[model samples]
Structures are given as C-alpha cells and as structure tokens.
Target chain A: MRPEIVMLALAVGACTWAFRALPFRFDLTGLTPEGWLSRLLAATGPAAIAALCAVSVLPLVKGAAPPAPLGAGLGAVIGLWVWRRSVVLATLGGALAYGAVFAL
Target chain B: MGEARAQFAQGMVAGLPVVLGYFPIAFSFGVAASRAGFSAAETTAFSLIVYSGAAQFLAVALVAAGTPLLVAGFTLVAMGVRHLAYGPALMKHAGQGRTRRAWIWAFGLTDEVFGVALGDLARGRRFSEAFMAGLGLAAYLAWVSGSWAGALAGGGALAAYPAVEAGLGFMLPALFLALLLSILSRRQMPVILIAAGVTLGVTLAVSATAGILAGMLAGALTGALRRATA
Candidate 1:
C-alpha cells in the first residue's frame, strides 16, 4: 500500500479509461453502415482482433519452443474444427488441446 | 426494469467463460507482481484499476526494473492505444441501443470483453447497456479476485505445475482467435490478413504498439478501399 504505487495505479487507470472512453464522445446515432466511417468501424473490429491475436501468439512461437508451437498448432486445428459450430466450444477445444500437449 | 435485469443476468452467464479464461492469467500476473516485489495490495490494485492484461504484466516488470513511473505509465498507455477504437467500433454495430449508462460501462471494455461483445453483436445479438454492465462487472470481479488469490498465494503456487501455467497463458489468445473466426467474413479476409501481416512485420521491426496501430489503420483503410470501389 505504498503511496507511490497507489498513485501509479491511479494514473494508469485514468489514462487508460480516457483512451477507452474517447470514442464514445462522438454522436453516432444515425451513421449508416455504408458510409466510410461506418465501414472503417466495421473493419476495426476484426482488424483489432487480428492485431491482438498476432501480438498474443507472437510471444509463444518466438523462441521456437517445441511444446508451445505443437500445442498451439493442435489448438488451432481442433478449435477451427469446433469453430464450425460455436465459439465457446472452439475455445474450449483449442485450450484443451494446448493444455494436453503443453502438459505432456 | 425487470427486462434490463434479465438481460444483465444473461450477460453475466455469458461472461462465465471469459471469467474462467481471465482467472489463470490474472493469477499468473499476481505471482509475477509478487516476485517483482509488489505487495499483495499493489498487485491487486493493478488488476482492479488498470485492468489491461499485457500492460499490467509490463508494468510489474518495468516498475521492478526501476523504470520511472512517468516512463512506465507512458509505455503502458502507448501499448493500449489500440483500445481507443473499441468503444466507437462497438457502438457503431450496437444499433442505436440504450446508451444512457455508456460512460459507466465503457470503463470496463477490456480486450476480452470487447471481443465477446463484438462477436455477439456480429452474430446478430442485440446490444443492451445492462448486458454490458453485467458482462464487464463479472469479468472485472473475476480479474480482481483472481489477482488477489494469486498475490496471497505468492509466486510458488503454480511453479510445480509449469505445464498448467503454460496452458493458462494461452487462454486469452485462444479466445481471441475463436472470436476472430466467429466474425470473419469473405470480404473482411483481406482486411484481417493484411492487418495481421502489418502488425507482425512492424512489431518485429519497430515495436508492438506501432504494429497494432499500423495494422488497424491498414486494415481499415483497406476496407474503405473496397467500399469505395464497390
């Protein structure tokens, strides 16, 4: 409970909250899906996910660890298989695959 | 009011998987923070407040390395700059829903929550402020509590099970990948591929923060290009 640490947490929280909340300030009430703004916003969702996934997975395969890639590969395969049905199931399948392989 | 309550309850239930996914990672963060000399309370504060998964871990390391608070804060915020897009992007798809409480719920737009919300909306689920409230709160509570448990357990709690640790580490990425698959469309394929490529290339060359911004812009611009030509 050091004073500096508390201050640091508050600062980080404030800055991040501002970043996340910035876009809500705009009025998007009647924006059409066909407009450039709407199109970009639509693209933003998948693109952002793409960027996040790239960054997340980059750490795993970086040093070429055996279990890491193997497990992740299995997870992707099984997850994709389950994906045809549901996201939750795909996630579970992927995680289980990775867990089993990484554990072994 | 009752309908809002029901929607909120539904959101919480839907958030259960995200709750499960986040706990292990937050636990790992707590252990890392402890190992980095953060007291249980400081470690918990990072989760309860900042709530950025990668940034929180980076904060622990940076602060431990004696990096100045200002520099560390700048770096963490820079790393999360991509989040600036999440709110507007989600609202655009949310279809003029009730937003009287967006200011309150928007504070909880963590990456997983954003992904889950985005996916649900893409799949034709209607947006509700109440639902987002329940979703965000559930995930937030899980994160804060998990960090607390990990902090109290200290660093050695999971050392004996390194494999499980690795598995837990992969949870967020797996969830993101699944969500990505869920919303992917033929038209958007190019956007996603280019975004991933630019992100990887820039991340390898410059930094992860630069990569994400570049990727998002590239993907969005590409989408705009297609829209214009169509």
Candidate 2:
C-alpha cells in the first residue's frame, strides 16, 4: 500500500472517530414541542400512509425503463406487504427494486 | 461488564448489514473520485478525509462544475449538521460515561451509529461503552474498505459493478426507513408525510442535500405547528 493511501485512511478514520466523540448537551426541553410533532407524523392515518405509498409508486408508472421501474414497483409492493409498518422496508424495497432492474 | 460485552456483540451483528451495504457505495465513491480527475491517491484521500457519501459526491460534482472549494466546504458542513439531529438520541446513552468520553464518542457518531444506538435505547436497552465502540468501528471499516475497493477498481470498473454499487447505496435509505418505521407511531405519520413531501419538493427545487436540511426544518416546523394546534 502506498504511504499516502495509508495516511488518507488514517485521516478518515481519525475524522470518523472525532465526529463520534462530540458531546450531547442534554436540554431535555428540546423534546417538548418537536417530540410531539414527530409523534403526530409517525402516527398519520392509513389514508395518508397510503398516499405516501402511492407517491412512492408513481416513480414506476411514469417515465422510465421497465427493468428498474418494474423492480422498484415490485420492491415497493413487497416492502409494503412485508413490513406494512416499516418505512425501512419500503425504502429498501424501492432501492433494491431500482438496483435489480438495472442489474438484472 | 456483561452488559458491555453483550452490547459489543450486538453491535457486531447489527453492523453486518451495514458492512455489506457500504462496500459498493464506497466503491462508487472511489470511481467517481477517479473520474473527476482525482488520482488514486486523491480518491483514497477523499474517502479518508471527507468520509461522507453524498457530501463527497456532491463536492466532486460541484468542483467539476467549477464551484469554489469554499462552496463545497460550506455544503459539506451544512450536510454535516444532520449529525446534530442524531445527537440527543446518541448522547442519551454515551452521556452515562465521563463527559470527555461522551464527547469523544459523539465525534464518531454517524447516522448508522445513531440508528443502532437509538434503536437500542428505544428498546430500553443501555449499551456499554464497548457496544458503542463496536458499532462505530464496524461502520468505519465498511466505509474505509469499501472506499478502498472503489479506488482500486479505478473509474470504469464501477460501471461493471453497478448492481452491487446501487444495492449498497440502497442500504442507507433502507436502514433509515427501517429505523423510521420502528419509531413511527400512528401519531407521527403526518409529520413523516409532511417531512417527506417537503424533502422531496425541496430536493427538486434546491440542492439534494440542502433539500434534506430543508425537509428536516419543515418537519420540525410542522411538528411544532401540530403541537400548537393540538
């Protein structure tokens, strides 16, 4: 390995370590209003949730090639189906869908 | 001591997915760096120095566009601010240690660490310092190794690895979606929707990374609005 590359890796490692070391000044009050809003957003009704899903799906039927679009659509469907309560699944599904479409 | 060991083990297991995910994305970062007139050494340095995915991508794009380094730096710092959002959640756990230690851990904190730590906290679990260290180390390796892979591949090779590359990129969104869903309650859906909508709109209108900041701002504001009405 080049000395320069080794040094670069060390630098990135140091920075990564540095960022993780920052302190958390706890002002519990920061949670007051913002916390409540996050709760509200998290609990949106099924209609709104469905709308979000629909919005995600729109990327499919609009203007794109079949492979990726199809993959995305299918992934979204699977994501929505597998983890109806999971935003992670949905997002993952979309990303995988896109990847699969492009790759396959 | 037992708690610390368990947390560390858990961190290792949980990080498996991230390691798998980061490889391709980091590789792409390397390739992009090479394409942007970066020497292999410079490409490696970027992953090491900047160490941010989107920020590095955008930085190179900006540089290519003839944007000033200052502009790139400003954009990077602005994007880095998102780390602040993850603060309170992480500090809740790391704060149990000495103030200095807490500060040190906070510096290494990234979305991945915050997500894992946050999830553990939500489950009413407290991580030993070992666990936090384990988590941070796992992500760091993935990022660095992945970056190295990309740099070694040179520019054109990434095109051949597009599937894996894109898949790794998907990990970030997937992980975020999962975390968001886990925490999401019926009450928080509107805030999420509005935030997502605003983020989407802003990204289309402004810079993509800037849109993320704007979206978070919009979400926070809307969250505040909803509370006032409630």
Candidate 3:
C-alpha cells in the first residue's frame, strides 16, 4: 500500500483498539448480575458467525431473475441446517445453490 | 492509563476481522473515488471524513453519474442519519466523556464496529480504551490500504472479477440475514415476514433506501405490539 494509505490504516487500527480498550468495567451490580448488557455482548460472536452464513444467500440472487430468490432461500435453509458447523460453508452453499437453481 | 491499554488490546483482537474486511472495501472505494476524478488525497479525505460504506458507494456512484455536489451532499447526509443512534447508545458505555468527544467517535461508528463495541460494553467487560482504539485503528488502516490498492489497480480491471465483486456485494445482505436469524424465534417470524413484506412494498413505491428504513420501523413496531399484546 502507498504511504498515505498505510498511515490511514494505522489510524483506523488505532481507533478500533481504543474503542475496545475503554476502561469502564461491565457493571453487573445487582440481582441480575449477568445483566442484559453482558448477555448482549456474549451474543456478539455468535451473531457475527450467523450473519456470515446468512449473508451468503444475498449474492446468489443479485444479477439473476426474481425467481432466483427460491434457490437462494432453499440454499440458505439447507446451508444453515446441514453445514451448520461452518460459516464459510453456509455462505458458499447459499451462493452455489442459487446459481444451480438459475442454471437449471 | 494501564486500563486503557488493556482494553485497547482487547478491542484490537475483537476487531481484527473487521479491520481485515475494511481494507479491501476501502481500497475499492478509493479506486472508485479516483476513477470518478478525485485525486488520491481527495479520495483519502473522503474516507477520513465520510467513511460510511453505503454512503461512500452512493457518493462515488452519484459523482460518476455527474450528479451535482449539492445533491450528493444531501443524499449522504440523509443516508448518514442512521448513525445518529450510535451516540446515545454508546455514550454511557464510554464513561464520563464529553458530548463533543462522543459525537466525534460516533461519526466513526459502522454497523459492525458498533455491534462489536456495544455488545462488549453492554456485558460490563472492563473497557480498555486501547483495545477499542486498536480495533478501530485496525479497521481504519485496512480501509486506507484497500482504497490505495484499489486506486492503483484501476476500476476497469477490478470490475472484471465478477465473482469477487458479487461476493462482496452479498456480504452486507448476508450479514443482515444473519442478524435477523439470530433474533428470530418461532413467534417472531410472522412479524418479521410482515415487516419485510411491507418494506419491499414501500421500497418499490419509494426508493430502496426508504424501503430499508420503513422495513426497520415496521419490524420494530410489530415487535412492540406483540410485546404489548402478550
């Protein structure tokens, strides 16, 4: 990357680090010690993982006909069900399935 | 100081993937901006100033279409309104920061970045300013790097790779689906479907952006109604 780009990258990296590193503790102070906040944070990783899979279906229908949504939908269901283990698989399955539907 | 550094590190680790993702997107943005007749410096400035992905895409597309700057500016401001929510939601988590500082950081918030930051903050994990900063910094670097890379490669050549292009385009929608699924329950499916239907209908009648906003509103309203009825 060019020097300017490199510098910009460094700045972004720095900003992310700062946000992640804020000093306040997650205060689960009451009866609900593991408060809503804690639960929400915990959900972040799984949510991201699921999103990675869910997004795969989107691309499959982009340039194709509206009926292509059928293939995309089926692919997402199957992909999420069978390849539930892998985010990449989930994504790939959706796209490939949609393509297959269009081809046929 | 020590606490800030530790939090920053945590943020860095958490934000690594986001940073990686931003690089190519930014690179593409840079290329697009440059092709639309912006200088390299101007391209970088856009990223530095109005860094939201969708808005950036719209800006470049509008400029390329020869839309006047005033129109582009208004469109961007309208599109960027969604980001305003980040400030109120995140302010308490950032500790005793001034409104100005919060607003500045709020401008930098993206869906992914906010999702990651807010989730962590809500959990009461001891905030590390450094970790948060590190994560943001990583994403920022990736964007700048990606933009520069895109600028160098030229738009025509980049457009030729259809698969990569399509895959990238799909990323946001896929992410959205995943989010919807995460919150989806058997009881909530109907409400979501209704919202989605309404959104698409509205979008067809108005604009795609309007559809997105309408869908979100409809979805939220349905959820609230269900809660009240239940």
Candidate 4:
C-alpha cells in the first residue's frame, strides 16, 4: 500500500475519533462567553470555509493564467446564492455560466 | 410504523436537499481526482474513507502538488477542525447519553448533516438517533455513488468533450462560493474577509496548505480581539 494512503487513513481516523471522544462541553465551560477561546471557536467555521474557497478559486499553478470560465462561474454562483439563497440554483447557474464561457 | 422507523423516515425526508447538493459536488470531486491522475479505486477510497467534501478536494490538490504525506495529512485535519464545534453544538440533540450511537452518528457529521440535524432540533423534534443515522446513511450513499459514477464517466467524457472537462473543473470553486455566500453574515464578515486575504497572500508567498493554516489562525485571532474589545 502507498504511504500516502496510509497517512490519509490514519489522519481521517484520528479526526473521526477526536470528534467522538473530545470533551467539548467541559472545555467550553472553562471559558466565558466573551472569552478569547470562545470567540476564536465561533469564528473558526466561517474563516476556514472562506480560506478554503479562496484557495480553491485562486490561480495556483505557476504561470497558468487564471481561467476565465472559473471566475465567471464563481461570480455567477455568488450572485445567484445572494439573490436566491439556494445552493442548487447557484450551482446550476454557475455550471451553465461556465459551460457558456467554455464554448465561447 | 414503529417510532424508530418513523423517525428514520423523517430523517430521510429532511436529508433530501443535502443529498441533492452532494451529488454534483461529489461527482466533480471524482472528475477532478481523475484529472489529477488518481485511479478510480483511489478516488472511491477517498470518498468512502475521508467522507469530507473540502478535505477530499484539498487532498487531491495537495497530492498533485507532491506535498509530503505528513504535511498533507495535517493540512486535511486542520481543514476539518471546524467540525469540532459541531460535536458540541450537536451533542444535546445527537449525543443524548448514547455514547456508542453518538460515535457512530459522529462519523456522518458533515457540514450539511450538522445543519439538517440542527434544523430538525430547532423545529422541536426530539433528537432521534435513528433519524440521524438514516439521514447520514442516505447522504453517504449519494456521495459514494456519485463519486463512482463520475470516476467511471470522467475518462470517457473528457476524451469526447474536452470543453466539458474544462467547465467541470470550475464546479468545485463554484460550489465553495455558494457555500461561503450561504453562511456569510455580518457577524462572520470580518473573519471571512481576513481569512480570504490571508489565504491569498500566503498562497502567493508560500504553499496552499500553509496559506490555509495561516489564514485560519489569523482570522481566529482577529475574531478573538474583536470580541474582547466589544
């Protein structure tokens, strides 16, 4: 088996176990509502998600120009999501926009 | 119908939206993994084992970039760390003193599942283990099946219509954009903006994995400081 596969399995397994075993309530009880840790935890979800989205969309490959189709598609997705509040609508709109741009 | 069966049925009904949303995203992951040179088996394994949309996508990118296994593994963990909050928020509903059942249900606590379960709770439904299990199982099947179908179809589709392949590549980014917009709020604006900026800057300077970690830390610190002063 490949070393990377093993590492992936172990990492995922550890995370799953941690989710089940960790004492979240006990830990939170130690902090006030306005405490730094509480605030940090509160922010982690949005921050991590935004970071993931940015990295995913940004041009990462060296010397590879940003793909216009992707940018347009992402814009469509954001616009549709804000306008409609529907993930399905946004995804479909983005896909259509991307296909349109790709065909051009 | 038995109470457990009824709850399970309700769970499945509630999970339909999540299942629909996961299909295209999972399919896109399969296509991206294939394009990144992963074997069909490997792609399937990622969905079955990791069972995380963002983490799986990041894993493929990290592997394509030839990152070290250890670094890649840790990065995936960091990406999933937000799930830790879900457990606490969900414990009152899903945990409910059944340690074994809670652990099993925890395995399926993806972002969408957490949202649905929480929504169910907010509507004054009693937290039923059977309900959560049914919801999780349905979503899991959709994800795994979608990945398999995509991996099998990706090669043939790409060979036939390369333009379609290019457009398909945009699916992940589009999906993420939609999710980010869905969760965006005045309270989260500062964190999201800071994180996006930090991620972009660090990615330009260093590596994508480093950029994500740095962004998370920076955003968290900024949030903490803001809260302390308010």
Candidate 5:
C-alpha cells in the first residue's frame, strides 16, 4: 500500500531492464576476464551474494534462537546434503526443521 | 516465419529445464514477499517487472527492513550489475547472430535463460531471436505463475501455524545460502569469505546498510586485486 514500493519497483525495473537490454545493442569486446570489468563481474556476484547471505542470517544466529538456527542451519545442511544444491529442498527442509523444532 | 516458429519451438524446448529450475526459486520469492507484507499483486508485479531472482529477493528483504528506498534501489541495481555482462557475453558467444529483435527478447535474458542460450550456442546452435523469445517466455511464465502460487499459499493462510511460519521466516536466508554454496568456487572463495566476514563485522559495529556496502566494496576490491597479484 505504500507508494514507495511502487516507485522502488519501477526504479529497479528500469535499471534492471537497461542492464539486460543494453549489451545486446553495444559492442563490449574489451570486457574480458583479464580486464578489471571481468574481474568486477566475477567478484561481484558471489561476494555480494555471500555478503547478503551473511547479513541476512547474522541476526538470526546472533539472536541465539533455536528454531531459526535449527531451521536455517539444519535445513541448509540437509537440503544441500540431500538435494545436491537444490534451493527448493534446502528452503523446504529448513522450514520443516524449524516448525518441527518449534512444535517440540 | 515457419523457420522462426521451428526455432522458437526449439527454444521453448531448450527452456524447459530453466522453467523447472525457476519455479521453486520464484515460488520462494513469492512466499517471502507475501510473508514480508507484500500483496499478491505487488509480489506478482515484482516478478513481472524486475524478474531477477536475487534482485527481487534483495528488494523484498530491504523493503521489509524499512531500508531507505534509495538504499534498497541501489542495492537491487548493484546486485544486478553482473547481468549487464551476461548480455554482452551471450552476444559474443553467439557469433554471427541475429539482433533485429533483441530489444524485445533481451528482456527475458535472466541468468538461466542466458546459460541455456549460451550453452546452445557453444554447442553449435545458431542464434535466433525467435528462439530467445520462446525460451524467455517459457521461463517468464513459470516465474510469474510460481510467484502467484506461493503468494496465495503463504501469508494470512499460514497465520494459524506459527511454528511453520517461523520456519518459513528462514526461507530467504536458506535460499540465499544455498545459492551461495552452488556458486562457490576455488577462485572466488577468498572473496566470498572476506565479504561474509566484513558484512557481519560492519553490520554488528554500525548499521546493516553500512555493513552491506562495506562488504560489497571489500569483497569486490579483494577479487579485483587478487588477479593483479596472482
């Protein structure tokens, strides 16, 4: 209901669209692995992702809450262990573990 | 036109795997958005508009945290900066390809779509805008529909199940961690580890916003400088 959500969505959308659509229209021959641009891309995805994961999870871990840690940690461990890197399984497993732990 | 249709069909078929892969993630995004207080319409609009899984997840989390709109917007865009290269990379791999309708189909160029298209090209498939369209559409529909389904299934519907809802609260972090693990490589390990450490430290010492920005900067700088030394 907040107007900010709409504006934020549209703003992000436009910027993302430009990211996806522009390279098709331009020549970026110099953007190679050896170049800083390549390393920047290479570094950015995982690093940002890792940072995001840590930032998001830190609060839960720091809270010392059993359900969250159990659900998130065990779920991720099991999900990764069982699904061989399936996001669905990990998320599902984590939620299940949390629920089961909370219930007990 | 028939050839285009055939190519499109081929693309649709190629996109089948992506459709399967996107559903769960999109569904998670939907559930997270719903739980984060987004209406089904707003959540669906996110997939319909922004379309990137990581960016959408970040957007939902940021919005939930009441992060300043500017910070959230910049973070979302920054997370997607890598995508700018996907297009160029795909084009490069697609030597002697079509570009006439790229403005349209390019919009569907999500990471998975790009991977499938690039793999096809690498395997000697000719580049075709029609194929890209087919691929993008199949994946896009799956994402939007998956989000809708998850949104409908989550939120108010789960009110009675506090335990389950608590578990689901961890879904965003769980998904992000899984994604992080999937992409973990020997080359990027240092960058990732340092980023995680820095993000935690700064966030604990200062603010989440400063922590994230600092983490990104530290991680990126580490990644860039390593190449110079090695």
Candidate 6:
C-alpha cells in the first residue's frame, strides 16, 4: 500500500475515534454571536479551502505558466454559483467551460 | 412497521436534499481524482473511509502534488477539526440511550447530516438513533455510488476524448472556488485574502503542504484576533 493511503487511514481513523471520545462540547444556547473560538473554527473552512484552491490553481512549478482553461473554468464556476447558488450547475458550467477552452 | 423502521424512513426522506447536493459534488470528486491519476479503488477508498468531501478532494490535490502522506493526513485532520463540535451537540438529540451505536453513527456525521440533525432538534422533533443511521446510510450510498459512477465515466471520457483530460484538470479548482465563493462574507474577506496570499507565496517558495498549513494558520489566527478584539 502507498504511504499516503496508510497515513490517510491512520489520520481518518484517529479523527473518527476523537469524534467519539473527545470531551469537547459547544453549547449553542450559550454561544454568543461574537464567540471567537466558534468564529475561528468557522473561518478555518474557508481559509483552508481557499488555500487549497490557491495551491491547485497557482503555478508552483518553476517556469510553468498557469493553465488558461483552469482560470476560465474557475470564472465560469464563480459566475454560475453566484447566479444559481447551485453547486451542480456551477460544477457543470465550469466543466463545460474548461472543455470548451481546452478544445479551442 | 416497527418504530425504528418508521423513523428510518422519515430520516431517509429528510436526507433527500443532501442526496441531491452530494451526488454531483461527489461525482466531481471522482472525476478530479481520476484526472489526478488515482485508481478506482483509491477513489472508492476515499469515499468509503475518509468520507469527507473537502478533505478528500484536498487530499487528492496534495497527493498529486507529491506531498508527504503525513502532512496531507494532518491537513485533513485540520480540515475536520470542526466536526469535533458536532458529535457533542448531536449526542443529546440522536444518540440518547445507545452509546456504541451513537459512536458508530458519529463517524458518518458530515456537515449535511449535522445540519439536518440540528434542524430536527430545533423543531423539537424526537430524532431517533435509527433515524440518524438511516440518514447517514442514504447519504453514504449516494456518495459512494456517485463516486464509482464518476470514476468509471471519467476513465471512459478521458480514453475516448483526450482533450477532455485537460478539461477535467480544472474541475477541482473550480469546485473549490465555487465553495469558497458560496461561503464568502465581508468579515471573511481578509482571511481569504491572507490565506490566498500566504498559499501562493509559500507554495512558490516552499512545498504545497507547508504553504497550505501556513495559510490556514495565518488565516485562522487573524480571524481569531479580529474576533477577540471586536
């Protein structure tokens, strides 16, 4: 088995166990609108996601230019998601945009 | 039908929205994974075992970029830290008397399931263990099956039309962008910008894993500081 798979299994398994066994609790009733910890946790998702997007789309490899189709597809996805609020439509729209650009 | 069976049926009904939302996204993950050169089995393992939509997609990108497994795994753990809160909040409504079953069910507590469970609890509904289980099962099946179908289709599409392969490469970034845009808020703008800037700078200077980790830390810390002072 690949080391990555093994690591994935271990990490996921540990998280699963932690979910069941951890002593953390958030009292929603007591949660203030300005609770920093809760807000921090919420912020993590977007931050991580955006970071991932940057890594995926940005040209990390030396001398490699950014993929034009990807940029166009990302624009299509953002447009469709804003207009439709539907991930399905956005993804499909992006895929089609990418295909069109690549083919051209 | 037994009470459990009835509750299960109701749970499945409630999960319909999640099923609809998850299928296409999961399909996109499959296609993205395939384009990243993951085997079908690996893709399926991701769906079945990790079962985290964002983490799975991120893992694929990281792996494709040659990130170390431990670093990628840790990144996934960080991505999943938010789920830690879900189990406790849900234990009261869904796990009540069954400890072991609840523990097992907790493994399936994706954001969608947590949202549905929370909604039910808010409405003062008596959600049963069986109901939660049913909801999880339905969503799980949809995700796994959707991934399988997507992988098969992706393979066929790439084989039949090589030009489509380049198109598929864009799927992950586009999906991430959509998710980010959907959740963007005025307050989050700074965090997102910081994360993006850090990610771009670090990835160019260091490794992808380090860049992601640095970006997440920087963004989260900034958000926390802002919230603390506010």
Which is the leading candidate under TM-score? 4
* lDDT at B194, model 1: 94
Per-residue lDDT of B14-116 in model 1, one digit per residue for the tens?
Answer: 7898898778667867887887899998999889889877678767766886867776666566556557668777877664546767778888888778878
TM-score of 6: 0.75
Q: List the candidate numbers ranked by TM-score, top first.
A: 4, 5, 6, 1, 2, 3
In terms of lDDT, the poorest run of 10 residues in model 4 chain B is: B93-102
Ranking by lDDT: 5, 4, 1, 6, 2, 3
Give the clashing residue pairs of candidate 1, or none.
Answer: none
Total clashes for model 5: 0
Highest-scoring model, DockQ = 5
List lDDT for all candidates, in order: 0.75, 0.54, 0.51, 0.76, 0.78, 0.74
Q: How close is candidate 1 to the true structure, as a TM-score?
A: 0.68
Clashing pairs in 5: none
Residues B96-200, candidate 4: write the lDDT tens digits: 464346667667777778878887799898888789888988888899988888887765566677566666666767766777886788887998999999999
lDDT of 2 by residue, A10-46 (tens): 5444544443444254533255544664433323322
Alpha-carbon TM-score of each model against the true structure: 0.68, 0.62, 0.55, 0.84, 0.82, 0.75
Displacement of residue B176 (Cα, Å) in model 1 is 8.8
Pairing residues by index, what is the TM-score of model 2? 0.62
By DockQ rank, best first, the candidates go: 5, 4, 1, 6, 2, 3
Per-residue alpha-carbon lDDT of candidate 6 for residues B1-230, written as tens digits (9 for 90 to 100): 59989988888998888788678768868887887888777788788888877778888777887887777777787777656667667766654355446656666777677777788888997868788888888888888988887877765565667556655556666666766776688888988999889988997798778899999888887777774544
Q: Across all candidates, what is each one's fraction of true contacts kept?
A: 0.59, 0.21, 0.01, 0.55, 0.66, 0.57
Candidate 1 error regions (>4 Å)? A2-4, A28-64, A67-99, B93-97, B122-126, B168-230
> Where does candidate 3 stray beyond 4 Å?
A1-104, B31-39, B94-104, B169-230
- Per-residue error for A21 in candidate 2, Å, reads 4.9
lDDT of 4 by residue, A1-104 (tens): 36567568667756854653464334443457687777877787678778888887776233242467666787789888878677656876787788778778
lDDT of 5 by residue, A22-104 (tens): 87777665566577866776788777888898987887777656744565456554556466545545555665566677767
- State the lDDT of candidate 2 residue by residue for B10-42, as single tens digits: 777776765665666667677766666667766
Candidate 1 clash figure, as a count = 0
